[model samples]
Target: MLLIAGLQWIVGPLIEYASPSLHYKYYMYVEQTQYMGFVVPAFGIFVLFVLVLIKKTALFNFQLGRLENYSNYGLVIFIIGVFFDVFGGFLPGALGFVGFILSNFKFVGAIILYYSQSKKLKKIFYVAILYLLITSISKALFHDFILWSVFFYMFWSLKNKPSIPVILTTIIAGALLALTLQTVKSAFRAEVWNDYSGNKIELFIGLMIDSVLASDTDVSQIDGDGVDSNVRLNQGWIISATLDHIPSNQNYFNGATIKDAIFASILPRFLNPNKTKAGGQENFRKFTGLELSQGTSMGISIVGEAYGNFAHVGGILFMGIWGFFLGKVWLFLYNQIRKNILIIAFIPLIFLQVIKAETELVVVLNHLVKSLIVVFLFIWFAKKYLKWDFNK
Candidate 1:
């Protein structure tokens, strides 16, 4: 699913024809057609390397029963996480930074919620979903919804074992909901995100409700015209733009961002206070030639970053190396989880985006650093001081 999202040329038909009314936009593929010839073989090589990694690592032995004891604490942490994330501006620097770190690791709460709900913890399951709805609608869900949908699909498929008819119906419904929601979400973002004088929560709620209730009005706004080259916004465009631009621009960063990311990862901003910005926006602007406004990010996925530094051959090589690295990390976590190392739960939840989004390498690495720090601290406290149970 994630790989497909990064393949705009292929999915164009899914949006344009299969669901003609769906007016979502993507980067034009034809402009980068020549470069994309290289991309296909590289992607195929990527898949082969991934398959080799999978063959070397045995299937993850997930032990869901071990999660039962952590359910209540998970709920509390998730709620606190929501509060801290939403209202973090009111907190002092250190406290706010702490909240930011903890909030990012709250994916552990999500894993716990899945198990608790599967084991039939009604309040935890339902209430958490409600809170999630409110928070997700607050500006992030329009994009992050893909990550949660993975959880939702896996959870339901495991528990219910629904019939083919039922599965088909649900998928159709979900596809429509997703398409419509994005259409409506764009409007809600434009209208509600900037305004703060009015009751913000009420506005969000009203907008969500309005989007669903007034479906036609929401879907009508999206341009039904085919992909626009200049208006490229999503992951594929950034990646394609990088492949097309780097051959001549001499803008090759030559793995400088990765080195910076490694450095940034080693030093937390709180301790260093001088942690260099690893966002690589300047390099991305130079590569894409997009006149982005200040404080705005033009995200170049790991694919783009890899290409920017290494060209085609080096890009594919580094991407393969990255695949091996991330693959091993995840496999090790799975093994640890099987042994009931509860702290490892936080790590996976935190790294979920790296696995899903084609995020820039620096951003991905920074996420890794933050998650590892959060996981180590959580495990230490939960085991040494709180005496939380981890034994299977």
Candidate 2:
């Protein structure tokens, strides 16, 4: 939570301010100084809730079960996930969610591999991690890698107490990698999307290496189509844009979207024909008065949405509540892990998309509610039918 929020809201802005080109490019509408006032406090309030609500004692300490069956089960789950991804479009929405949950089976499988005690499983872990890296590169999407980092850090930290130097080195390395990917992904994506004849993975690797080697040169400043991918890190712009546009040109949402998100979470599209759609372009335009291009999709972050709905004080309060709720959910799941070790697998799946700061409340809530349902149903089924002792 702290890492993502700090990077998007804090570190990105500082980098932008340091670079005249980046500042001029992204801060044309709202100045960085003006937006930081809103972004910093909002982050502070949310982080306070997280810190106050989370129990340090419950942070780690998970029980172990047999690794052989667990690793095999993860592999099977991963293969099923692949099947769903390949064909889920043909299935109905309710059935298709299975694909959504399992879409990143590589991550899930990697998590399983991380927990496995056997040294023999290390080879499989490498395979799963490599598959994750290649597929993320080929698709030009690095969000999975971020989530994988979170999973790795959390599980690893639970076991070992790494020194500060190691932690700082990891953070610096990750920052550089993120910057390199942000710099090159625009071009890499164009090739893959446009059906480049050459090998896509090789193209991605070449682009990344070139971007890294040329880090000192200004020639690498070019992003495709004149759009800065650094904006991916500067979600504060949209939030600031929302504050600028809302309640003057447009009235407050008054919780209409939050209500919509709740309805979307409970009612599948089959049941609720008018359920909120996934892309969030509609909400974005309605709230921010900015129409995205046909293929473009962006969300007013939870802070933006909260303020848009309830003004400054209400929005900040709502953020606090949201943070507290998230912390409670984290604690609740770990508690359940005591009863059923299988819940271990579902932890990352549930929080996968929820941790993102750029998505709307609708996406966050919908994923959370549905993931909980999936987790509970799987736990019940395993206890009643599978009869393979998870408690073992």
Candidate 3:
């Protein structure tokens, strides 16, 4: 959490702030000191959030249960998850939500399979590599690889408690991996996104191999629409820009948008036909009064949203409340893991996008609410029909 927050909010922005000329295309709307002024306090709120979340206190012990045919069930759920991923779009209307929910079984089922196996490291490595390749070739997205690896690591660390050196090495490797993928993905997409219908897996592999072999190529140099790693990671600019714009050129939303987010989370599109969309484009245009190109998308992040609704002091308080609420939710779910470790599998799904500071409140809340509903439904089905008490 700290690593992602620091990288996105502080380190990435600082890199851009210091080397403004390098990222001149992505200019900062506000002055250096002003950016720092808002950013420092914003980052402190994130630090407070983590502190609340990982607060070390004694947890109540609960009786553990052995799940019946747990590994087999896990494998079946994983296959189902893959099926949803391949053909989810074909589903119509609200049935699509079923596919979305079950799609997460990919992680949940993989976790079950990993825990059921005796050779934990070997199992996780193979699972992670397979997921990496599949997501890379099919979607050209690598966040899932990192997310699932970290998810698996959370489970491993519960028992293994890796040393400082090991933790540092993992962090460094993950960062380098993210940077490398970001660097190469633009080139990959450029070659494949156009009219190329050749084998994607082969194209991806060839691109990666070529990138590795080309020693003269500068990774920092922007290729067409590609953003450098620093700019890609830097979300502080949006906050800075929001602060500069709101209540100046346009009046404050005064909780109107926040209210929309709350309603959007609870009410489905079928019920509330005009509910705010997920892309954050509408909110960005409304809140920031800035027009983004059709291809471009950016959100006024949580911090920006807070300030937009309420000024400085109110924003700070909003952030604290938001952080505390999320921390408590985590604690509640974590406690249940003692009763049934299968519960841990859902944590990644719930907190998947919450960890991203770049996301808006609407996206976060919508995902959280729907994921919780799906999790409880799954659990209820297991207890009632399967005749398997999770607390057994």
Each candidate: what lDDT? 0.59, 0.73, 0.73
> How would you encode candidate 3's per-residue C-alpha lDDT over 54-123 as one tens digit per residue?
5752454422124223666666667777788788889987667767878878767776666564565227
Query: Lowest lDDT 10-mer window, candidate 3?
Result: 60-69
Each candidate: RMSD to true structure? 4.8, 2.8, 3.1
Task: Give residue 8's lDDT in candidate 1 (0 to 100).
Answer: 42
Error of 1 at 270 (Å): 6.0
Give TM per candidate: 0.78, 0.89, 0.88
- lDDT of candidate 2 over 85-135, digit per residue (tens): 677678776667766775655556666666666776545656666776877
Candidate 3: regions farther than 4 A off:
21-25, 57-69, 118-125, 156-163, 213-222
Model 2 bad stretches (over 4 Å): 14-25, 28-37, 57-60, 63-69, 117-120, 156-163, 215-218, 226-230
lDDT of 2: 0.73
lDDT of 3: 0.73
**Which residue pairs in candidate 3 have backbone atoms (N, alpha carbon, C) closer than 3 angstroms, thus clashing?**
none
Indicate the TM-score of model 1. 0.78
lDDT measured at residue 322 in model 2 versus the true structure, 0 to 100? 89
